[model samples]
Target: MRLTPDEGDLTARAFARLDARLTRDTGRPVALALSGGGDSIALLRLATEWARARGRSVLALTVDHGLNPESGGWTAFAAEAARAAGADWCGLSWDGDKPQTGLTAAARAARHGLIAQAAREAGARVVLFAQTADDIAEADLMRSEGSTLGRVREWSPSPAWPQGRGLMLLRPLLGERRAVLRDWLAGQGADWIEDPANVDPKFGRSRARQALAGAAPPAPEEARALAGGRPTMDGEAMVNVRRDIGARALAAALVCVGGGATPPRGARLQALTARLRAGENFAATLCGARIEAAGDAVRVMREAGDLGRRGTAPQVLTPGVEAVWDGRFTFRAEHPGWSVEAARGRLASLSDADRTEINRLPAATRGAWPVLIRDGALAPVLAGEGVERRALVAERLRLALDETTHEDDLISATR
Candidate 1:
């Protein structure tokens, strides 16, 4: 259904505010994760019009989780809706056997990965999601019932690991209520799917949704606030500690420097944050990141023992295939090499300069750093042997320090 004049104007203003939030990528398309549900259907309608008005285009992506027999029908419906809305569409599928446990969280992660990969390939720096204020309420309720789901925000970097790198999620509808959107869709004569899973009591979200069926969402939590100068990264993937850093920001630094998928949570993370905030001189480890504080300055790096305990070992570098080791370094090879392994036990064989550099890092950090193989001998990575390798410090640090971690105000950056 075409938007009424008021609806069109509302969408333009809402999206225009978001578009101004980030650097525009000039000519790249914006992507929407279209699930054929009420929220996404409304989003598809609004986005197509919003994009067209600004001379931009929209790509609607649907991920077929393959859990329901009706999933195919859902995907097809999504395609048709996108077409009707004047947006291009693509369908992705989760093709493997479903795990018996943790299915919901797993499916969500898979969906995030698929959408993030597709968005990047389409040259989008941001992917639009249709989460509304109801989602925030549900999350709060679920957490109260002991769920582990992270709190949803109006905007965040995508949650999928490396796949979600370089992309941000735009939830322009976060301030909108689910019921209001559904009511508007009905008035427009637009239809959407009501997935059976939503009402299934087996799921925490479903239970929460049922409990609050008609209850107005409580005031949304204040968006996460970030303050102070950003943390610095030394050559060794160390985040130089600073006073007055937020716990969330400090958690982000630990996760990045430690090469972990997510930041540590609960009491330990809070304790660490407290220490740094006081500018105390202490050494501690949380997640895989080890901290060395000297009162005047602090350094955070990967704990090599953590890597070994986690069974990090050598692996062959496959030509043309991107390889990630310790989640800290990524390597691609177009020619022969022995393997990518830790610098421990093999530091003596490296060139003098390479050895010196490696040794300069804190002793606990050097072992987890990557060292390449040349002619079956452990060696520092050579410059011209058809290999490409980089420490992922800059990219990870940038994400951790992204100032908009808590603000959603609907402004978006161009890619």
Candidate 2:
């Protein structure tokens, strides 16, 4: 019986590609979302061998969606399989009420969020996914059927909001077929769970999978669309797209500003994108972001809302603990007894110069800016004494505008 993947085999090579991608400290464990399915089980086994040789560890996380009656059993199997494969295991569950209409999408988002949080807490900067060649074909088919399921790539930043802030996802098995992995598992005498949902007709993925009729996965070619035109961003992350930007680029910019899970719909987004390309002067709202375009320049920012409703929801800071607020900013405080909230009522207390600068921003942004607070006194966005703050929205816009963003979305073949 085979105890490890053959060194020259595709599976081994797939795991080997992780060497250059891991930029974190060598001591930190690499994370995997193990579902006990054929693909993930194969990856966990192969990765176990890969990590051991590199003096690293693997953390396998199994998320129990609780949608199936046998979910508990699946979780148990995943834990056992991970441990048997010489990897650490953790079981996470989806604990809230399920949405009746979009259970699939909601479950996926929740699963990602849970995994991202767990990985971050464990100091894992990269999350390994078992997305195989078959999964890619299936995603394409699902999209053709008008499903909004996102395009899966070999490597990309985690799509889950705030929780996925600092994590990158690596799909090493993207070049391998599901059947190849299953055959390898069989050779290794490994058993895997088959989730019944994979065959359910109600789901788009299931339908897409069944429609394949055993066709081969498409070639490992790049499918991302690269956009043109650089965007100028300011200190506030106000994006000014002067030249031309694609729908995806605009959508990404709005995602940063809106800080919402859902991007703008295709029709409305295409319409607005056309207007921007034509250099029309107009203002509009999509998702939670407000856009103002003038003379070939498009600027986006978070829309002003009823901040008092939640009042920016002050989050107590823990010493050396990093937290994300409103999905736009990441905050870290060196010492405790501090918190972060909105610049609502405290805006009136700003110095004359501070007030003048704040007024320069759109009315949509003035009151909602994040403020560091201590003993009920509001501190400026630039907090003192070991406080570290970063605007996630700005980073997102920068990535969206960078031409190399899409070009570097895949793992290097040679590496």
Q: Count the backbone clashes (under 3 Å) in each candidate.
A: 12, 0
- Name the TM-score of candidate 2: 0.87
Model 1: per-residue lDDT, tens digit, 1-415? 6755655455655676466543432476788999999999988888787777767788999999999999999999999999999999999999889999999988998999999889978987778899888998999899887777777666677777677666788788877778767866887799899999999999889999999998888654455457645778787477786767777778778888887667777778778778777778888888788988886777888888787777756788877887777767778889766578777767677788787777788888888778787667645553436778777655766655555552232233212
Across residues 1-415, which tens digit of lDDT does each residue of candidate 2 receive?
A: 5434432386547755666465323777889999999999988988888887778899999999999999999899999999998999999999988998988888999999999889978977778999988988998888787877767776666777777765677788888888878888888788999888899998888989999958988755453654755555656656666537877777877777877766675678999888877777898888677788877556887766645554456788888877877778777888877788777777877777778878888777677777777756644553647888877776555443332232133222101
| lDDT of all predictions | 0.77, 0.76
**TM-scores for all predictions:** 0.87, 0.87
The all-Cα superposition gives candidate 1 an RMSD in Å to the true structure of 3.8
Cα lDDT, model 2, residue 145: 75
- Candidate 1, residue 129: Cα displacement in angstroms equals 0.6
Instruction: Tell how far residue 122 is off in model 2, in angstroms.
Output: 0.8
Clashing residue pairs found in predicted model 2: none
